[model samples]
Target: MSDTAQAAPPDAGAPPRTGHWKLIGPGIVAAATGVGAGDLVATLIAGSRFGYALLWAAVVGCIVKIALAEGSARYHLATGSTILDGWRSLGRWTSWYFGIYILIWGFVYGATAMSATALPLAALFPFLPLWAWAMIAGLVSAAFVALNRYEVFETVMKLLIGVMFVIVVAVAIMVLPNVGAALRGLIPTVPAGSAIYTLGLIGGVGGTITMAAYGYWVNAKGWRSPAWMGIMRLDNRVAYAVTGIFVVAMLIIGAELLYTAQIALTEGDRGLLDLREVLADRFGPTVATIFLVGFFATAMSSILGVWQGVSLLFADFVRNIRGGTESREELTTSPAFRFYLFWLTIPPMALLAFGRPFGLVVVYGALGAFFMPFLAITLIWLLNSSRVPKEWRNGWLSNTLLGGAALLFIVLSIAEIARLITG
Candidate 1:
């Protein structure tokens, strides 16, 4: 890429950029961050229990995410503002809400992300306890993000994603998914008692609060004007295309192996551990070992993803809240960014030793539910308002999809709340 291709706006107040792709980075980072072991477990559980019954739901999730990402990317390209800037323009309340939410979200997610990354390693080695592995994982992720720029960050992310893709796809092929059943799954039907699982498959399709970080990634990639729109779109599409394939492959493994065998795995990352045993039984120790490595890749990718992306988010939040101009370089090196990165990596390790406090888990779960609808409703509001330029605004199709996403998230959020309440 030339200096011209990778340049930021000549003036901060310049018009929309008319640029195209010489490189694709942020989209891969976003997709990898969005799908952790939790996502894989959810898809696998859905597949094993439901047997491709929610394939369309997973597809719907990919579509919803694409819409959210595009709207976010467009806002940055059109306005040269971070999502925080856009939100701040909406009201001071947006800043307060995000500032509070990011603090709470990062603290809780830090522990979970670290633990997820540690699980496969613990299982593989069996020498160190899970908590010890978790501590090491957090330290490694923090040190890297604290030192690297977006270029190195992106390179490492793509490499992790490549490893993830190969291992999962190989597992899927080994399973030999039922072609007719999978095709039927594409038609979209809810079997008895599977409504919530179906909704989860659809709504959980590779998303998180990190969706807002799409613009940060875009800016980090040096795409600031609408001119880079073509490259942005291409990058975004490729990201989700890869995400959808990974989800489907996990589903195939679930349906073919677990469903047929009438065995149900435990939930969360431990579920993948159970999967390793099954793979060892069916294939061999070597294949299961490879699968476990892929599992680590998925979990660690998420840890690094949030380590880089959300830290950027926090740094930007500090810049805006302080009423100071924030250059990308300044933001990357800013104390606030490194502080959050340290916060994400170091403090959470305590949770591994002491165990996550019960009171903390409840608060974490509630706030987690709060984010998806928050992102969806906020996007619909931001893109449709005079805030965005007419040319870059949402079309009817985009609005319809976003509107549907808001509704879907609303429904799902309600379900999560109810589950929390009743249980």
Candidate 2:
């Protein structure tokens, strides 16, 4: 990959003028993959503690992510190169950072994702132990990704998104959210002792390393050039808007049911199980069961998305580092892709039995903490450079948002590292 901008695809013509709605696959995948159990828990905890005070943070979080996702996809569309290619052009150091981060991140994340996915299932059906359910979920997700291509994967993700939207939003409405209070929450007031919760709600909504994979997914969706920029922006915005809805819905549940009752949930994924128990007690087992089903959909979607999206990333990383010339479309079936999918599925099962090693957890947290900042900083570097065509160079608005995101993630990373050290 050269620093000079690659020529646009021959098909690059006038940007699509109609049917923008049809160009929505990658954003859906990005959203499904980005929002997992932990995000839901974070927003729920914020609402439980502070009522509707941090609603502004959730909306801001969505906007921050929209900026990040759009910037990443824009680089790919404008440069006729993958995000990894842009990183390669930056220097060898980017590769070193990513290489170390992806390996450690995937190992810990595999066990974490499997456990989160298995939580709802184990709660719903206790015949199988949590570990057994986790292993089954991991294996099934691996198989699903292994057997399907991007089109099939996108179809399943869309279906899961529909399920999540219907169920979670339905439950929030059932709680009869105070319209006036939720409206007032949009004012951005932070109550005493709620600063960290406010930051978490603002920073945690639908954010993940999979965000960097948005470009690969954009390619996989057959939108390979600058002509698709309009639809891509539309797709990115719509996806995060849906993500905002999910975050708000979870916050509503927490404020109405738990905050009002003065109830506290156990920390981590188990908090969701606690919510199910509360739902069962208050609304009956039927609604609780439905929520459990929705939880499975949320967790499973993350599994499928990571297994597919991040694998595409790992595959690209390998190709870039090895100087391989395989096209982006071929990455899904590449040996490197299969190896990463396997890495994400099998080896992490050991952690399920023995538990995450303290050292590994420290490294994972440190690396994961800085990833978003790294992404923000790099996009600002890449998009403003000679690599991207001048016509597609980021405007002042993009620069400001990306700058804010960098500062925000840097703050969050420092906070995360402090927490790990103290613990």
Candidate 3:
């Protein structure tokens, strides 16, 4: 098919449209996938250290992600091609970077996701050790992704986010947050010594490699052409709006419950467990238990999302590498997909038992740091070039947002690499 012929929607003259709420799927999956336990913990730390001072950062982070996700989906719809295809058009180097990145990143991230998911479960049900719980979480996520198709996976993600939303917001409300302070937080101001936290909150809210997987989710949701552009944009915005709320709610919890009391949390996912104890002391066992459930929902959703979404990405990579033309649906069931599913589940469990290797951790950190910038720069290149239809090319607003995102990620990447080297 001619380029224009392939790019044109089946119904060429359809009216412009907006998304109906019922059509929201890929965005939820993307949002759920992106906002993992680490993002929440970072926001929590920001709130604890500088109560509501960095709230604007969370809001801006969401906006940045919305731009990134929207750009990704727009490419998919405008060109009737995968993001991997767009990358391939850039150069063979894109393939090499992605191939190496996905392999190393997935192996490390698998353990991280499993460990994050296991934390709350271990806290809530202490009968099982953390490693065992991590293993179970990994296996269960693998099984769910293996058995279900995109529709089922999306439904489950929606349900998980629902549980996450209600419980987290409820906890925030229970804290009786300082409304005036929160409102004041809308004004951007960086307090002394808060530069790192401010940068992290702004650049790390929902940023992840999964942001690049967004187009795959959009494609899996059966949106193949530009006719779905309006809905896609709506879906993307709504998803990040929800993410903003989650981050804000966690910040409120930290501000009201921890900051006021001068209680310091242990770092990492364990910090959440510390918050659980605080909740139990301040409220009761029931409230602490509820927060743990929300924590599990948040972490488990990430596991499910990565297992499914990134597998789709890896499968697409394999298909493109082989010069195969498998439909998105077929890619889900393809051996490449299952192999990644296993790659993300089984091999990583070893990390749980033996501890993450120092060298592997450094490489994972380096690659993970660079991925967001890579994605943002590549999207700008792909969307602005002839690879995309002229009518569908990014406007000034999209370009500005994406350009800013690229700059922000580049800074964060340098910081991460510097940290790795210094340590």
Candidate 4:
């Protein structure tokens, strides 16, 4: 064969292929982080309350994620800047909002992630008290982030994802309902007693502040052009689809296994731990063990991901604010980056000592509810304007989806605020 024939076809007369799978990075990491413990609990509650009637919300969540992830990736590909840079182009106000948001969000989320990880460890091995296990969880995640390079971080996360994938998806398959009912979930009708949780599940489906980190992941993967956009979309789609499946599986467990069982799982992550005992009772110890392992994988991955990913964001934020002419590469590797990483891991340990403040949890949720809408609205403005090249700007479809996400997020945010205030 000629050299040209052997080299594989080029994309739009650009460089020849090395392969596609090698390009998958940010989408996987962002999607993984977005589907954290809180998200899982949302799906579980939806399942327990309404069975598969609200499954459409989970599907809607997947769509919202794709829109948000694509918007972030689009900014990077079009403008050759981080979303932070894009925000800077808009004005200092954008940067200020993110700065305040990250500071408050990180403090509260650190404690929440640590506690979620600790709950399972305390369950799996009662040798340690919950607070001690929580502290250990924080330290272990800190070590994982501090010790590993990006490639190693990605590998470990993929492994954790695999554990979650096999167990949760397998359980879903094992308890497969009639195909008709599952397919009917796609029609988008709200079931009785499902208005709030349905909205919650839709909002929860793979949504998180980590969605902003998708652009950075793309930068890490070396996908930096309009040419790679198709593959980028595919990557986001596949990642979030897998995320949706895991969520739906948890919902199925709630619906099929726990709904009518007369057991009231506790609030927050303690509820998930309680659900494990319910699993043990209903499906035997092996299934319960599977639940525990899956829970730990979900929690630990979220911790490691937030520890590394948000630290990168924080480093960039600080560098941008400091304005000392640092490059992205240097910003990520700088002392400042490591400092924020340490900050994310350590100071929250104070919360572990005193027990988490209920006020902070409500603030976290209330503040968190606004993030998706914030990201969505910002991307619509950034990616659509002169900040990016015309070739890489969001097409009509991307805009429509993002606009829909913004609207959905607004409604969800109001609902969340009402719940927080009322509770």
- In candidate 4, which residue pairs clash? none
Off by over 4 Å in 1: 1-22
Highest TM-score: which candidate?
A: 2
Model 3: per-residue Cα lDDT over 1-423, one tens digit each: 123321212332443454378888899899998888888888888888899999998899899999999999899999988899999989999999999999999999999999999999998889999999999999999998887766778899999999999999999999998999999999999999998898798788785888888988877776788988888898899899999999999999988888888888887778888888999998999999999999999999999999988998999999989999887657777889889999999999899999999999999999989999999999999999998999999999999999999999999999999999999
**What C-alpha lDDT, on a 0 to 100 scale, does residue 388 get in candidate 3?**
94
Q: In order, what lDDT does every prediction score? A: 0.85, 0.90, 0.89, 0.78
Q: Model 3 — which ten-residue stretch has the worst lDDT? A: 1-10
Candidate 1 lDDT over 1-423, as tens digits, reads 233332333322332344434477789899998999988988989989989888988888898899889888888898867788888888898888788788888888899999999899998999999888998999999888776667788889999999999999999999887899899999978999899988888788676888889988887777788877777888898899899999999999999989999889998878999999999999999999999999999998899999988988899999988998868656767789889988898887778778878877777777778788888888888888888888988899999999998898889888987887876
lDDT of 3: 0.89
Residues 168-244 of candidate 4 have per-residue lDDT tens digits of 87776776554676677667888766777877777776757888888777666556667777778878888888888
Q: List the residue pairs that clash in candidate 3.
A: none
TM-scores, each model vs. reference: 0.94, 0.96, 0.95, 0.92
